[model samples]
Target chain A: MSRLSDLGEFGLIAHLEKILPGGVSKEWSVAIGDDCAVRRSSGGRSEFLTQDLLFEGVHFLPGNSKHWETVGWKALAVNLSDIAAMGGEPVGAVIGLGLPKRAKLREVEALYRGLARAARRFSCPVVGGDTNRSRGGWTLAVTVLGETRRRPLLRSGARPGDSLWVTGELGGASLAWRAERKGKKIPAAMRRRLLLPTPRLEWGGHLAAFGEVGAAIDLSDGLAGDLGHVARASRVGFDVDLETLPRPRGFAGLCERVGVDALEAMLEGGEDYELLFTLRAGAEKAFGDYARSRGLKVARIGRARRGSGIRWFENGREIPRRFGGYRHF
Target chain B: MSRLSDLGEFGLIAHLEKILPGGVSKEWSVAIGDDCAVRRSSGGRSEFLTQDLLFEGVHFLPGNSKHWETVGWKALAVNLSDIAAMGGEPVGAVIGLGLPKRAKLREVEALYRGLARAARRFSCPVVGGDTNRSRGGWTLAVTVLGETRRRPLLRSGARPGDSLWVTGELGGASLAWRAERKGKKIPAAMRRRLLLPTPRLEWGGHLAAFGEVGAAIDLSDGLAGDLGHVARASRVGFDVDLETLPRPRGFAGLCERVGVDALEAMLEGGEDYELLFTLRAGAEKAFGDYARSRGLKVARIGRARRGSGIRWFENGREIPRRFGGYRHF
Candidate 1:
């Protein structure tokens, strides 16, 4: 008889994983507790199924039409990140919209306009949806179907001694959030990154095609939290060198000006939408070659080890664990 | 510049259909404005995708744990009915859940238990989903994927002079709704029908296999309003004999006791989840034979005509058109 607030986000998911059935059935390769569920029908390629819900006021404000458009882009982009985490290309998407009675018709249209923009960019068709009147703020749920010929990446694939790496940089979204809360001006680049994240679909596809990449996850839960997922799934521990972690330009300076701890932001901030993955031992050179050839900037920041949870280190000194990432509950 | 309240539900959908792109694409046979979006991929059978959103207060009240469980069942069942409307078998489903901060852990678990029950009943696997915190009431969005080897039924397939038919009795849900609104005790059977509807998956599959059913739609929006959808989509009209409409046992008596118009409830009350379809000319007998063999109770109620809108009649007298069905807005 506990409240959901006590269980928190991951706790609720854990409960669902136990109560729900049909994990890896005959037609499914994977089910719950992953970036996307993998279904493999006979004579057909494996498909990925993922869904994300965004609530107004919780996820975004019911602002102007322009802001609503960006919210729409972000709603679909987050689900696309899940597809990218699985190294699959999106096939189609269906959206479920719950709008309050007072919402404007133009705002709904603008939301779709943003959704259409992302769909076109990712080559995923907006297939169908259901709309209903809500007693609350706006609710947008997008479910994307993805397909892949290669073996889709999973968080359980990482082994001890694997090198941990991340694409692009971290802490931008978190920084923007902290700055906005403190009534400080957010950096324009960080604000854009927060509003409209570019899913690393190409990089994920390349990693899957390389065939030697280990566990992978999108950085929606920041480095410390996402690595914990990989660690638990892969039964391995991570030793991250905080100094080697990639950060957005002037991220530390901006955090200092806003009186927010940059290290805490980089480790626990959510919604970065960057890919964090591991490479098998001795495949680093080959992986680096492929990444460079594709003009992808990736940084090796840590190594998986024979332990549990994440052990953060800075300049060979162990840092005490503090942040627990972002949780909705 | 108008509000969504002004345009209403269907009007917003029509606006979206025009604004959104990639309808009937190379890999998609149907997109929007149908029971489900049909996807025809190479080397794979056609797949249907649909989504539905249910909000607390709008769709249901957040009562006890048992009520939450029924809410979960209805959320998935409605999506299953969409697949049933298309004559397709559900492959898998992904749900997006938005829970208020004060929601209970047991309530969420109970909700999943109900979802598990419906998923097991239909053999549609609940694969993956996203859970988020809401600033308002609970929001459940479900997207189901369905597969069909036979040609899926469409609302636009009915021709002039085709016989319209419906599976099972109607007005049970609508009657219960009226009873609840009037603070009257509803019949147990009617209450159950409103809470947990059985999607006619097998009957729909049979209709698709028969390949002679003209058009199909699930009676979610009541008899008269759903007919309007088929009429507009197929570019035909309907002539329904109100006397021939099937009703639950004591439906009229209950409506009369509750001070509700029986005819209006039968025509415009929603959430029936029954299959409303048309039989091709000369296929009625064969269809009846199949339905009888399957222990299905079906009745012929009307005919599609070469005109616009619906014309109701009883015993050679035309009834005035009044009810427009249940609308959220």
Candidate 2:
């Protein structure tokens, strides 16, 4: 078992810096070690910024977050997913953690390691942040800044004729979480899926270049809920085919026992962190080819129409729920 | 008493978005309802980011920050201070709030108002963030994104003989917090100074352009603690002349009554959030000129020496202290 005493906070930060890519230079401008990282956005590109906070018990249960490193990776991954949904490139992030004193230093250091790994992978630096001891539960918050070369993918851009596409499998996380919560046996692959989520970075750039990907939002909050957000914003309705959701291996049968539609799990069970986006109707083949060449899963889950809300199809009949999606508030 | 109910959460968001100089739209490249904002970067500009988490009982007592609006304003102010110290041009921010259920709707609206007011004042937008009900007191965690043009003011850049400069008066916050705690009537001016700190945004730009603001840091955890970070990072020592330290209004009298070093308040008191930077010789004139033009206080509190550690002065002699500086951990 590793301990924070093995690598002090400075050592931890050094580890992170060492792992990150070498794009930083004095001229690139960073003001660190004080309170903030001072930067000069003299570059011609537009800047994108967003922040997300995860509080224990509120955002994730203890076992759901698993290890501190997983929490850190998930933090950066979730933020990166946001950027990816907008077809933005990750640059830097500031992390603020309100850690309960009960947390171990080893866990904190491991958490940094996970963050550093993701930052290195994404070429974003851990510029500057604040840490404090909290009397409450552990809280992790990160604000990420990114840039894009062209127009961003917005949920409001989806039109009635657009076809929705999702990257990778969904419902795996919900299955994994439920299994883990019940202390049931989960396959190692499913366990991994539940932990580290790959933010669709490469596909994000492609989607942006294609100009066919209309409105897009990430599936941090499952499909139904996030789609509801898109629908509410765009004032359009969607009809989802229940059979189209890509469930993780071993969970297909469980969906039947749960007495709920698997599509509902795909729509409402969150933590998938995939890009759920709509593209121009005619661009489906192009997207399919793009996904096939990328060795990715691009599913045709639904279609946008000139209507009001979302509806799921089961046995050629419409199944509706009172609530459209999960409410985190 | 204006209530948050007057501006519900969605209403508050709309209000903030509406008040921005250029409200969120396609112009944002990426705006609300998406995961993150994506913009293009400036030439040679790296993204600079910082997060400021304002705790109700910890960072602020029940007096000043007890009101949600002031809490929001101060939270944004602290983050802005971080951005300013880095000499980063402010772009935008995200507010991650942990609000108690007991907090009134008006208070929440006022909080958003304060948030919008500061965002517009700093020319930064409040892009996207997370808010949740808290079991404890309010926690306003604000993360800001900024950029620099050329050289970044880093803590590692200070050399021996560099003149250490402070941007403005400190210790008003301590007095304010104490006043509010004691329920004493503080002057309206003092109260304003304490409750709302104006970050030195313009001064930061001057420091970066001057080409001799060797190393800089924001004084958030008081002067001694924050400057100690710079000194340690640069591997240099510092000697502060007591006479050169700037004192706030009525500070001298207050120090006399307390029977303590007035300079220590400037040194160890927390939440000043002013810029404390070291300048190479010959750059002082330009820096001083800019500060004066900006109607700000400039203090040559110390100078970097060859050795490490810091020393304080009483008239002409070195002074000793019981403990080192303000403790954040």
Candidate 3:
């Protein structure tokens, strides 16, 4: 029998999907394969549901490597990112926690404090959940429920003429990850960006309600892989200009210090948790102004074109798709 | 600092609750501390959400001991039971899975087949979820979304005069568990009761719509523990008649074979997935008749009183509470 490592994460998902009974319900607006499952609720509104699981060793390490609080924050933040990707207002979340038998009460408390911090910051309360003893390692599974007044943003909504835009800069998470690996102290700002990613709730809500953005997805699996998802779903091609991609402050210096290519980090690093989307023509200036007003960064880096596959250009030369970002397996 | 086992499961939940902000929302009809969290969705309908997690070694043992298919069935069935407790129709579900690196693709397929079985039986489609690599054992976390047109049955709604009723038999799961512990082959029927519990969705819906059952909960954490939850939530006392408790066919023989007490199994055994509910006085006959017509067993075993604490009785004598049931910590 083929092992899970051989199938890889995405391959396993596809295999499981084929064996599962129901695909999409007629009552649901969107189902499996989206950032969030969307169903029409009572008040002519759309309800979105998403779930994510984070496992120790696979997602993060305990001990001095990472704080339990930061682990908890990222656990919930990933789910919140799914809701934000759909332009939905998160209402509540249920967390299913599996802790090792030897876990300390203080560590659990610290984790809850981190979860509470994120909950309050996003106004999405931690409502209810289940907890159990784990004979193995710790695991945190978070499920978030949200609602949208308008139609939810979908990765399949991008059109050929739409310009691709991204929120915030990339490579900071990669920098922090490298720093942690090298036993070097990471800057607080970089660590926060890596550990406690802020889901663009307000920005996504505004875009869904007023902005002319078409398709949207969260950058949890780096720009290349996530953009590939949008491209595949929308059945369109993308031409991204590497020069136009936004970089964090001191990004070049950080990459140089780590002996890595800055452009590679921006393209292939995961856990950025920024929003990647497509905008209508002539809407870039307005969107940029809105981001400036809100103290958020918006970068226009690519455009959807009539065709298939993602092509990259760095200073007028096509860059081959060498890597497809992070893979869990 | 104290360890998690020092606090125990319930105590840890209470501790976490105190530190977490935003307990209840005005917009939510029901928040935490229930079988499921409920909120009013658009179009005058109530939406219910509940989550559960199952961990290997903690909840089950894979490989030669237990079938992965049965594990998948129980994982989804537990969540379905929560929806039944709320008297709601399950709309969809999201499952977050964590698998060890050595997991086989065939085993994963078997697990999905079991999940598909339950989903088809309950009409709750597997809509969306996330999967990741696990450094430890496997974990399955499921979140179910459901809707109810009528008022949801809450654990806090039982009145002073309500009669407690349970659908289906108990003790079968305990018998199966004992058999497994003894390394003896469990009866196929008993094994099915333990591993593939049927959620009482129809009965719960009927009770919610017409039978006047007030408070309801699914039997997961034994009769003693779950009934205590109802008593505490409703602020009422319960008087349970031990003699009136329903037992599975050949339950006495199985208990005798396993060298266990049948009564203890009935009171302290868990994973029954039976619906434990309270009906208004005079509604028993109608409810019983409805259940009979539907070929289901309904046992009236107790009553709610105007006080706190859960008390047991046997033949006009009070039976002191011996054990408080299973603790995760």
**Candidate 1 vs candidate 2: which has greater DockQ?**
1
lDDT tens readout by residue for model 2, A254-288? 76654446665677778888888898989888778
Evaluated on CA atoms against the true complex, candidate 3 attains a DockQ of 0.78
Leading candidate by lDDT: 1
Interface RMSD of 2: 17.9
Native RMSD of candidate 1 (Å): 1.7
Q: Is the docking of candidate 2 incorrect, acceptable, medium or high quality?
A: incorrect
TM-score of each: 0.97, 0.82, 0.96
User: Evaluated with DockQ, which candidate comes out highest?
Assistant: 3
Backbone clash tally for model 3?
4
Give per-residue lDDT, candidate 2, residue B163.
Answer: 93
Model 1, B160: alpha-carbon shift in Å? 1.4
Models ranked on TM-score: 1, 3, 2
- Name the runs in model 2 displaced over 4 angstroms: A1-46, A63-66, A257-261, A320-323, B1-41, B44-46, B62-66, B258-261, B283-294
- Candidate 1 vs candidate 3: the TM-score winner is 1
Q: Candidate 3 lDDT, tens digit per residue, A1-329?
A: 67788887878888899888856767777878889999876667888999998888888788632488888788888889989998999999999988886677888888898899889899888988998888778888899999988879999999998999998888888778877788777578998898889998887887787558889999988899999899989999999999998988787887777777777678788888999999987787787777788776688898999999889998889977565868988
